[model samples]
Target: MFRRHGLRATAAACCATALLATPALAGSDGPGAPGAGDDYFPGYGNGGYDVSHYDIQLRYQPTDDHLRGTTTIVAKPTQNLTAFNLDFALPTKSVRVNGAPAQFSQDGTELTVTPSEALPEGSLATFVVEYEGVPSTVEVDGIKPWIRTSDGALAVGEPEIAAWWFPSNDHPRDKATFDISVAVPDGTEVLSNGVNTKNASLAGWTTWQWRTTKPTATYLAFIGVGQYEISTKTGAFGQPLVTAYSENLGELAGPAKASVERTPEVVEFLTGLLGEYPFEAQGGLVSSEGMNFALENQTRPTYSHRFFRNGANTSVVVHENAHQWFGDSVSVDTWRNIWLNEGFASYAEWFWSEAQGTGTAQELFDHYYASHPADDPFWQTLPGEPGAEEVFSKAVYDRGAMTVHALRNVVGDEALLDIIRTWVSEKRYSTGTIEEFIALAEQRSGKQLDELFNTWLFTKGRPPVGEATGVPVSATRVAVAPPKAVAEIDRTHALLHDH
Candidate 1:
């Protein structure tokens, strides 16, 4: 999502060094974690509440190009209410709550449901919604999905396309369990979050049911349906898993297969470094699309054909996988705080780079410093922007990566890792803010970090540092003036004589 702006050149130099020298700070309450009650602006709109759990059973027939499903939502009222509202993504055909027909409204983009009864606070209520639609091709910033020629693979990106085939919140702020049952054409494969508990063929189609025990952000919930070959593996806790890819790209699947095969190693490495894996099941899916990047959709990650070709060289896989901890487990409360997700993901790239011994961690910082544009406007951006577009810019990614680098430098690797592990373990299935992160960092680092955060976050531009130092340098200078005209000289002489 980094914009290639020419203006970034000026700041790039400073960002590189500043990132390395920046100190670790306490985790602060900068922004709330996803699914946490909306505290930013009260009474503006309903936050991601009222729905505590989602049990969705769906059927997808690829041949008919149609999807149908029943979604049972268990919700609790966060506030005292006479009426209940829930937001659903995509086009829905029929919806009912507690077996009674429920009235619904839609604006094409979002479907809102109004329950008939006033559910008291802390009381649980259930609603069922059914819908079907021809899955819309995934698009982001006008980019269309295409099968990758490198492997004839297909993958989805740019948010909840699973909801394109179902009815649910498309935002990551709402994390809930989903029991997805997909029925695809007999030959095609179906994959989703969590462990695959059942797979059966019925009515000329294959029905795959995946029960996710772990709570997941809506965006991370997913399903990849197509002709795919499966590969199996195991990770920590002896969790059984599999990686899927198109049959045509069997040869090129090596790297992707290797990457998937390394899932246990990656999980162990991260768990030993950050914390335990936060989800019940984890795997990777390789698709034919040349989307801009890969998506870390909770348990099952979707990757572009490019990822499989270069294998581990594409850090997008690592970045997305890291979200299982940052974006999926803890979650970002709003798009404005997308840095909490993107920044951490970008930082994971460097963490992996450091682990691979490709270069010293400092080298990673140098890369960010050299690549970041000087004129990047993220420094001047307000946190309450409508979408996460600005926050996901390079400033948040690279600069944020540098922030983590600086923190590691200040706290030392062991302490930093400890803090990270603790944060994930403690905040699992919950939400947190930048301030909260800062507090955790300070508590773990045993040092105050306000000055550090100020230098990197609050300033209008990169902090003046040694590499891009703004120090004034003295230089020999000359002053020149226009020569006086003869008429002016004569006038001055005449006036002096009169005096």
Candidate 2:
């Protein structure tokens, strides 16, 4: 029973600004709330406990797309708890609480557990859930979770994909460090977030151990297991830039390698614009898996094989990589504020295009303003308040980009970069709400932006720009260095040697 988009929340009528500042009040003595009380996905994250780390060990069988795993979740309850819930979707064989077989029952996606002893406030606890089944992606409102590749699997758990593969808190706000080990047969390699500390072989199988010490939202945690041509390159700060592509991608592998090879160049560009690259290592994956979209999965972003097309531009590349700063590192407090991710990344594309000397952000902003009629759904929809399905709609991507451009027009480029740096520096590795972001903007720009935010983010219909702040500083058409076309890669020989 999947809905097309997120069902409208029936909870308290809360706006993005209101939903973001929700404090985690200590839980009562009874059972915790089945849901985390997130205004967007009520069935998502759980209450009472806060997760600190996840040690996920998955043994995958490619023949039948089956996965067997034991997930170890380390958490601390905020209040005394007799029972708590975890979001798990795979068929579980057994469950244990801190090595004890706790009484448990499953209802839908929620796995409710009553521990042998009641967990008191500030008490540490662990849950080990043994699950095995053909983990299918959660499909709702057109957004699908994991992608089942031809040979193995690719797990990109944005929104609710993690629950489909592992039992844990399945919301963006509940971030945790991860030690992910995906064991696979020889010929298939496992790629995940952060640094690859272990890749040891035993008999016919290899275990790939990836550790991300940085706290990561569940949505950004990813795993890709497939036959790949892995490449390592030196990036900024001399971190290894690791990329992988499915061998079966055929000609698609060429553009994929090309796009991925530019990872260093993109990181360098983004680092100059936005403080620094947020993760330890930067890399990418190009796969035959048929998820048409690209995800900003923490350190390594994943792209579909389709984007390797000759016509496909690196704007998507710029977009997803920009998410490393906007989405991955500085997270949204609620799904309602997803525009903070999409909008910033989308605006980064405009910045890239402007830097490339072809189109100015001003020109792109004007074109959308003129081309789309006033009543176009793109302009009519609000990013601060999106329905389940409308999360990534034009309001999120295009108009979101437009919102950033409008900000740039308000504060000059230098000041805008200052505001951005302040945001990422202060909110890095943490969740924030729209109100906080608005306050930061106002403080940095010394401009009361209630009208501006209300016009662009909150209200619907075409946003009006008062004639005062509409004028943009002179943007000369200067060719940005590292002269690779948006769609074309400078390196061609990289593809010839891909094995």
Candidate 3:
């Protein structure tokens, strides 16, 4: 899974138009290609149909951590479809197409279905599935998927982790809207992606229905289920905001609240620095799940207890929330272009640091560059196409941000921010690739950046000495003095030391 999580929503007929299928005509009879032709993870993402929306309804039994689910998908065929596949992991009870029982079989993660009637290209189809099993954490290519918590679950579906919890074309390339409804025991609660449309109790169970009003990638779709203390308020942009945590967190709850409450101000800050916030609502979630990672999940970001342990790491918050623009809005078209998500978010930490006078981007870049030895393997890694095993490697994070720093050095701070703002505005609710970013940088900076990219993103060795990427010493004085962050850092240290 590509990390630093963020992405999603909405039911639009136009959503079926992800990478329009031109191979087969409307009347041409054929099977849609499985796996949307991705260079990495060839087995993920089914071919043949473009899904418009997903209606997922599941009931979780806390006692056994068992989940029974019925999922309905609305999609359009790219080729005249005889059979299609959904990447599902749970044991299947039944499957139906257009209300008629469909022949279905599960082979590993893919749930293949043969409809009674062939679906013509451009025609809409509905496939529904019923399944029940204890949802388990999946280990895919050494990546963690849906993690079962002490009292709940966190769905972190980077790369192909989505299939662990729900069945669908589990790839970022195939984006769709979602309506997630989860039912829990009487005392339990659920917080998922998008706006809560319904919260009702029946027969000693409560069902929470959420609707996402934006096209969401399966990896970005999420469901946090268990006993949660839910809070709602207006966000920075006045969007509907929601945050959740459990009493099980104990003392960490106080710091979690304080850290999450900073979201409004963070959004406002990033909004001015980047562009407008992408989602209609904004929030965050804290869980006992020990993912040791925080995900920028659509409108709501999810954090691990470790973050709250140190008063919710503002740097991590800056990293994830920045994903709203870089990863969530201007998503990567393929897993190969993950640097577009992580690199920008990583650079955002530098941006926060610079603004608060903690450290400049160049200072951070210098720290990493100087700390690592020449042949330390870190220098040999590339952020772009960092093979499967090293997808989330430091090369994708620190080096990626260093690449941004190098670019910022070339284009200057103002042009860099302008280029980012432009990229966010242009690619909102859509996807882009590394090449597109390069082109955008050149266009915005009016300078050739090919060399910088080659040295930072493509090279397998340390870049040349002092290859340009530091602001003038005089400019450092312009940054705001760290009065508040200093206090906050002290408070966090006290919290951690107290425990």
Estimated TM-score for each candidate: 0.77, 0.88, 0.88
Model 1: lDDT to the true structure: 0.58
Model 1 clash tally, residue pairs: 30
Query: Highest TM-score: which candidate?
Result: 2
In model 3, state the lDDT of residue 46: 77
Q: What is the C-alpha local distance difference test score of candidate 3?
A: 0.75
lDDT of 1 by residue, 372-426 (tens): 3457564454322323334444456656666677677667788878888888888
Q: How large an RMSD does model 2 have? A: 6.0
Candidate 3 residue lDDT tens string, 89-129: 77889999888999988866767888888888888799989
Specify the poorest-scoring 10-residue window by lDDT in model 3: 5-14
Give the deviation of candidate 3 from the true structure as CA RMSD. 6.5
Clash count for candidate 2 is 4
Global lDDT of model 2: 0.76
TM-score, cand. 3 = 0.88
Instruction: Report lDDT per candidate.
Output: 0.58, 0.76, 0.75
- Candidate achieving higher lDDT, 2 or 3: 2
